[model samples]
Target: MAADDLPDEVPADPALSASADPAPSIELLAGPLEIVDRITIASNATFVGRIGETEVVYKPIMGEQPLWDFPDGDLGHREAAAYLVSEAFGWDIVPRTWLRDGPLGVGMVQLWQDVDPAQDAVDIKPVAAVPGEGWRLVFEGYDDRDRPVALVHEDSAELRRMAVFDVVVNNADRKGGHILEMPGGHRHGIDHGLTFHEDHKLRTVLWGWAGEPLLPDELARIEAVRQDLDAALGETLTAYITVTELVALADRCEHLLQSAAFPHPRGRTPATPYPLF
Candidate 1:
């Protein structure tokens, strides 16, 4: 059925809804898949569905549109790889994601995250002047018809952690809308298909911490991921990206570790994404 025909929110399947397991088993996800709703605005065909008791965002490989920068038919695996890196750091920023065979062929399936609509921390707003304390200026520009406008984001610790994650993963498309604000002020980063690009492609909205010194705890987390790369992290990522890309990931960690500061975007392409939100 078309996306418009489906309900805005479909109730989870009866059998799947009963179980309260926080993470769904791989077996269930690879088994029968049922689409509950379609996310139409997504570049690729994306859906919300129940795999056993878990509601997941499924992005089938068949639906992925070819991109000039990324290899074709690899976005799903890239998404899963980003989750692996997030797990390696124990940051809990990226949600539970995996690659599996779905009704529309193999794809990335991630546990659906329910974001609190009340929180506007990640929301980009146009302001006449710099926002006070809690907010961080992202960039300043003029709106259409030549009116001055400034884009600013929240300056929360959770977002800082996410910015670190994006740096490590070389995320090429860290759009503002991709940051999910969960209950209790927790933050989750999603849509990581454009990551691990073997080159510096770290575009994002969380540049508020740029050039700031890395805290001891944050450095420790980076160190942990670097140590694990040769073993668990490396092994898991090989299934998703090229060996060269893996090497680039390690190099990025080292760069961050040595600098001990948030990176200032360099090179030609603009550091921030278009349509900032």
Candidate 2:
């Protein structure tokens, strides 16, 4: 795609949800027509253009000096770590995440999944009862014959578990827009910039499994993460994560082992400072 073919600004879509009060306008980053516009989808993050058809999510390098209070650009780093760990654990929920330069400078890019709501029906009431305000983007998906389908299902066991993963990682921001129900039975998780704090900040909609035992496979996978920490994977984490943050990551693993449970942090405020959709 030629740069000239791309729009100077991304077309605003009401179907999408964002935390930016005055939604940020999309802009071209330095690249081919690869990335189109900057989109603010959550309170603290934004999704930019595509890298060869894949969604490129650009979260700013926020710090005490910036309006957003994320520390040392650690949020994005933790998300990358989470994706690396999740992939190693054999979980297929998180989208492929990688570090890249974005409209706001350096950030992360993720894969986008096509969601057709009608074909994959989900229980919405439980999600509605999720005690927060979030925008549910209603889009139409079609069959080859042009049949219409809305692919938003809030109640699926697989989706619930992916939510669990977010909490375990101390994800402070999980909204309806962050959960993508893709075509052909796929639900992808995104916007993982807020997670892995020293404290328990598991705020998400997948609380259905709170206090439940981790499946044997899940526990085994956790053990594998513990073992892999000392290898090159640990080096990779060290590259981006501060020493304090790395220690916090280890503590979460220990907490999981001791409780034989997924423990929500005591008295930690909402992962997101405010409601986001």
Candidate 3:
């Protein structure tokens, strides 16, 4: 991928720099994807590649495992839908993601986030550690060695936005590793193939703000997304999620606006994804 091929400003989490994005829309999304390698940790056929100079993660529909709940070969659409919702909230919390035909088949391609290795939004610490002054505890348990440990995340407005984003999307998987800690403290969530189900399936390590009143800005974001649902946003997502799920997405936003608070974890499903990291 040649750096000089595109324009100046880029979209969310440009893999490299301004050279990667001047006008970031078309070339990146509609690309001749070259596969550098597979992202082995991902469950699906995931790869790292580029349209030009920009780096991206690609998940082919053909590689998705059958889910008892979701329709097959459409995980890419759900991921794109999640990106749309994140953009609607005016928070680039999901990174830039879109659907396109890739080297394998149709899939979701997203800009690779360059996370700061020194930062960890969510962490597990020894239960006896005392310096949790600004962190939120999700739960406590024992590690594999039968040692006591605590599941925790930083208590901050940035992470709070991500938590709200998860609730609105009914994100079924918000594992600790999914929360990418960007250089500037902006936490971006990925792997949304499990999102936007018609049913409530909010699972995460971010239960710290349960029942807390929503901040004014948080309410505004939710309200804005609600208003857009029946309009452009709804229309765009129709190509991705089912109509029922789209309506359910709207309903979730409205519920948040009406309650004006973060929700408590309540569901038959496990409240957190497995292999938390």
Q: Best-fitting candidate, measured by lDDT? A: 3
lDDT of 1 at 96: 80
Query: Under the 3 Å rule for N, CA and C atoms, how many clashes does model 3 have?
Result: 4
Ranking by lDDT: 3, 1, 2
TM-score winner = 3
| CA deviation > 4 Å runs, candidate 3 | 1-22
Residue 243 of model 3: what lDDT?
92
Put down candidate 3 lDDT per residue, 1-277, tens digits, no spaces.
Answer: 2324422321222223444444665545564788998889888888998877878998887899868877656887788888889888888888888666667766778888789999988888898992467999889999899999999899988889999999999998899999889887788989999999999888889998988999999999999899888787788778777899888998999899989999987859888888787
Task: Score candidate 3 by lDDT.
Answer: 0.82
Error of 2 at 5 (Å): 27
Give lDDT tens digits, candidate 2, residues 1-277.
2223323332121112242213222222224325566564355656566654445556654421222445454566666767776665567767665454444555555555567866433323332342222222223345456655432334455665675567556677666566677777677777677766666666664454456677766667667766676665566666555667667776776667667665543574753324334
TM-score preference between candidates 1 and 2, better one: 1
* TM-score-sorted candidate list, best first: 3, 1, 2
Q: In candidate 1, what are the lDDT values of residues 68-156, reduced to their tens digit?
A: 88856688878888887887788788888776656776677788998899987655456656678998887777788677777777888
Question: What TM-score does candidate 3 reach?
Answer: 0.90
- Winner by lDDT between candidate 3 and candidate 2: 3
RMSD vs true structure, all candidates: 7.0, 12.3, 5.3
Q: How accurate is candidate 2 locally (lDDT)?
A: 0.55
The backbone clash count of each candidate, in order, is: 0, 12, 4
lDDT per model vs. reference: 0.80, 0.55, 0.82
